[model samples]
Target chain A: MSGGPAGDSAIVVSDLRKSYRGRPAVAGIDLVIPRGEVFSLLGPNGAGKTTTVEILEGHRRRDSGDVRVLGVDPALGRAAWKARIGIVLQRSDDLTQAGALTVRDWARAMAACFPNSRDPDEVIELVGLADRRNARAAHLSGGQRRRLDVALGIIGRPELLFLDEPTTGFDPEARRRFWDLIADLARSGTTILLTTHYLEEAEHLADRVAVIVDGRIMEVGPPQTLGGRATAAATVRWLSPDGPRSVQTCTPAALVTDLAARFGQDVPGLAVERPSLEEVYLRMIGAPA
Target chain B: MNAAATLVRAPALLAVTRARARVEFLVFIREWISVVFTFIFPVLLLIILGSIFHGQRLPGDVDLAQYFVAGMIGAGLFGVSFQNVAIAIPIERDIGTLKRLAGTPMPRSAYFLGKMLMVAFVALAQNVLLLGIGSAFFGLDLPDTVGRWITYLWVIVLGIASCTMLGIAASGFVRNGRTAPAIMSPIAIVLQFISGVYFVFATLPNWMQTVAAIFPLKWIAQGMRSVFLPDGYQAQEPAGSWELDRVALVLAAWCVLAFLVAVRTFRWRARTDD
Candidate 1:
């Protein structure tokens, strides 16, 4: 499946501000996502990831901002603009209402939203829900419901898609399968803006990642070096006589060399490592657990 | 996109509306409780109340059965159309149906329009049931004036519009889907009681009648009674005259007011905005 016309900036936002009852949810945030890129917006819960995503999706109005999604301001986005953007809300509203409606029926119903939509069966297959295509949505498991949400979002063949904590309730196997589906979509040139609390998901799926803290972007870069995580002090751990011993230092090569000379062999359980994406993300959000 | 394509891509307003209507219709019919509450329950009330008050007298010599039957027709109209939405819409909004559809390429008006259409259809059917039962058991006569039937139709439509808007307003503030029936049932029961759904409003104290007048449910029932019942059904059925134009105008005004409130207050997402 060929993707749509690639854009240099699939989405752009400058000084976006949103408030409810005088409390700013998204307080003057800026973001840019290039076309055909899987960009993850990582944050703890209530860090404005949802608000930012909502504004970009044209689902919420901004108090003030100059923004663009697919070259049109989402605030003024008409029906045509919406057809090109798909969203998987934290909870799929369609799932509860699915009742007796089959998966195929739901897919076809969502497909009717856009001028050019994907084939229902193809979308169902991509989500790995084709086996339950005839089953009612309400009867499906949590993982199946999440897959259905993905199916509906992509059925319109959206140029830009938003997945809000899409794998929240997914099992490990289901999540891995979903990651594969997302990778396929990204490879086919769909611009994806994914907000997930799962750091591994960010590391695995995101071409670039942005960490938001208290409604502000703390850092935006590839997950490996996010906030200088890769270059930060590396930790060396080994099984010393006492038990596990660890040392933090800047020059891990020197430390390893010294260890080799002293031990005169491979230090038992020797390993050098930098901060993981989860560590960096948690530190950035100031939730060091 | 060109103008032709743009025009064709106006969010499939008709399709979404039709689908929502069909789904709601099927779901509503499939629920045995809704069927009984809307159709069967009203029929049972009609029979029991008609027999109990067959020879009861009122200030206007209006037969209690005839009076109760006419009011119930209005009540049926209000219940199926207004109460239905007041109860259902809030639940849907709390559950995220409204917000979910909002982001899609679907026009927002289609949802309410299809509901408006469904309300009209259901209200008409309920009227027929009330009239049929009234005719066979209570010996009531259908309206002879084509103008009266047309006026009755307006009353039902306007009445439902107002109630549906109130439902939207409630949905905007309500955060829990489970609390919807709990919250709306009392309002429905109160309005049904005051609108003479189970009894005549004039029997209540003068202050109660004045309070009930603020709502369109009473206006619709009183106005409809003027059409089906004799001219002097109620002494002050909208300024002491059975003017269909005035009833239409009054009900229309309530509809406009409720619509404005609904638009201003209706939250697409729930209060917590999940």
Candidate 2:
């Protein structure tokens, strides 16, 4: 009935646990997401990102422990909290059979869920779907379908949003556009929880990132420096008579300077780089070398 | 906010309910196949059956024209309340639409209430159409009292609620489109036959009369009969006591049990884990 409960934290889950019969999906996890920050939860398949999101969304019940979203216990949100949160599902719920309820109709429909929902056209524009506002939901291309999902998600003008694999089927350009839409929302002080298999999405959008594996949080930090990435080491690559070669070391700056001198000029095909977000993320998830 | 404050949020809830109602209505119109099946198909069945059995009186001297009127009326209500609700829901679930909505901040109860409201409206629409047919073709008499009208209205409502629950209950048990009809049709058809929607139960054998009495559909049809037919019709019919309150009470009980089953059995995910 109110906007949110009294608390500084946007979302707080303390030892939250949920099980399907006897097997735990979210096996005792504690998380505190600050308001107005874009946080990404990175995980592989069956790694509990969806279960945790579902629990936080109040769609599924937690068998034990305290879970709070937008300050109120989600288990007891009672539609007040639901009005302030938006969710962009991984799969499109395109009513191809339910004809011609256009973008405007959808926005109007979702707006009714909240007392103070956003204007439909503004939401359409926000999600880069203005051009297709009149088109039917089922007629949209895959990338455009993702945009519609974002449109419906933001139509409520939610304070917090949960995007589960939002750009999973997007092409490169659409993915970049979606990143901009998310960044714009973050700039407007809407806190977001993003879950994705695309490490690049996490690297690009997250203000803070958490790695989830085996139903556990393995690491949490900024994307650039997660999993000891900032100080873990760097790789220096250069063309060699023995073919292109590379070495990992802590002192990449010093190594690059030495390589510049040894090559007697700018090193041929030479590049000095820290590990990419994907590389670090893959390694953190324990993918094979 | 306190419970008092939540109660005061009625205006917002009304808006949400209205919006959902509009969407559902649009869905119905767009789903022309459902419209044809729910509305036109029943009308056709009535005409065909009426024509086939014309001139020859029912064994119990059952009014075939009035039977067509009553049965179609009940069938129309069942279509929206039980038939469409059951089928549309599973398809919606199989496609993950309900799970998608679960992610939104929409109150879970609002979803059902909105649906109930929508079905009630659609049933009203359906009843009026059938009422016109009944009056025009069968020399039907209007409800003798406002009380009878209210009684009939609520019976239709209860019938819908029971049907909706059956749909919801059935939706929980299946995960795909293939099994939806398989699960729904047999029970629905059986209810149609025994509940006096297609035939007056008095004409049936004694064993059937006893067996049909146990179901919600029987209560609904009996309740509707209490409204549409006069007291003399009951004496002639020789089936079902003319206890309007008893029928209402029986339906209300089934309604509560169905509501519980709907809530307890509801599954949002793709499949039953078991």
Candidate 3:
């Protein structure tokens, strides 16, 4: 609201740093996310994903570095600037204050705060909460409560949305539904910054993904090609007369042909497998991979 | 220019306050603990105390029941405005409700205004309940003159303003929801006792009376007594007169002082957050 909007990018950070006491949380990080992009900050717990997002959301202040979210420094975000962005904080069992308001009622109240907001009912339906419209927030399941959170976030029709581990406790079915809702929002051209530890989730929803570990960005690229997954060596395995044999090679096709030639026919129990995103992410984080 | 700025914000501010008041009222009604403590407990005490001290007369020939009716009104105002705001807000902070609202574009003033609006409604209902019960069963007399009614109205208004601000300021000291009642209730109960809401002010020890004089509750209760007690009863007061000016002065001062403290101490995030 104070400065002109940054061109082309929704978020830009240069050496963004934050620390708690004497220890660093988001140690120096740099990122640039283009407008309308669904970018995910994927990392394990304590890896600075939430800290970085919270800084971007203006919920926390940075100790140092230049950061721009929607072209305004979040530290100086005012009401007019806040109205243009939406935030979905990490799930906590702190809805005791939600009281008896039904989902529709809550959505309508939140919508009233924004200057240009989507119709509450439409946003409810968009998040698949139409059937649970009249349920009090206390009565909704964890997934439904999260849907309400998301519904409230988008009710403002934010040009930029921050989803901090939006589907942490969701079951598989609920998570799939939540992902679809996010994909719909993205297709509508809303830029989404999601933080999650779920490899499949980032792969499913993010246009580009950044793998973070210990307050640093380990890799930033498309999930399919993260850590060179597209070009990484494939492992070829087969049951030979010696029992079992395997080879890690960039040319899996050539390896398979030679194995077939040795057997003079079909190779027994032969399998060629590329590293999944999970493996690549685990390896990037220095976890057991 | 200042008026123009207010004009631009007035509509949205009023709308948000009204919406918040509606939700706050619903939440207050649903929480039976808050309702019973704020509205029901003081009236119940008045009845129980009035009956126990039935037929007893104060120095001014004021019946014990009539004396308590005035005190309970002040006590009920404190319970509804001060205790509720102090304890409820910390719980909101503890549970992240305040944190969530901070990110919204809702004007901060609207939040406090919404709370005051809700408190006004609840305090009015509390007064009707206390007065209706007092007159119906305890033979308490209602004020008969317009002047007395005016005094009654200002006492209630000033009492609520001062207490609500103090409550907001006190909320900052609460660390979490679990510990809030433990910390808030003792302070509220102690203030009521020392302020002459629970006993004869003239009978209180010298140190206690001196201490009570420094707080708003004593002035609020004394103001209520001036409105309800018969004419010429001021001889029983420590000052031997209805010091209406001093009463108004003390309460208005507390409103300003507590407001500054509240603004300085209010925390939007829960303790767990950085």
lDDT of each: 0.79, 0.75, 0.86
Each candidate structure's TM-score, on Cα atoms with residue i matched to residue i, is 0.82, 0.86, 0.93
User: RMSD of candidate 1 to the true fold?
Assistant: 4.8
Tens digits of per-residue lDDT for model 1 on A1-289?
1134335789888898888888878877887788888999898888899989988887777888889899998877877788888989987765766375778877876776666788889999988988999888888988888889889988878899999999997889989988998999999999999999888999999999988877888888988889798789999998888899899999999999998888888799999999887777777788754
Query: Can you give the DockQ of every candidate in the order shown?
Result: 0.30, 0.37, 0.40
Better of 2 and 3 by DockQ: 3
Query: Which structure among the candidates has the greatest lDDT?
Result: 3
The digit string of per-residue lDDT tens for model 3 on A15-123 reads 9888888789998999999889999999999999989998898888899999998888998877777777999999545453556678887887777676677899999
Kindly list the per-residue Cα lDDT of model 2 for residues A76-182, writing each as its tens digit: 87655676788886665544544557767777777776656778788888777788888877787777777777878877778999998888878999899889988
Worst 10 residues of 3 chain B by lDDT: B1-10
Instruction: Give candidate 2's error at residue A158 in angstroms.
Output: 2.3
Runs of candidate 2 exceeding 4 Å displacement = A1-8, A14-24, A63-66, A94-100, A237-249, A258-268, B4-11, B58-63, B104-107, B133-178, B222-232, B239-245, B260-274
Q: Write the per-residue lDDT of candidate 2 for residues B1-274, one digit (tens) a residue.
A: 6767665532266677788878877777767877887767777776677566445555434456665567667776777777777777877776666776665556667777777877887888877877776767664566979988898878887788876776676677666765777777677788788777777677777777678777777777777767776656776555335677777787777778877888888876666322
Docking tier of model 3: it is acceptable
Error of 3 at B203 (Å): 1.8
True contacts kept of each: 0.37, 0.40, 0.36
Best of the candidates, DockQ: 3
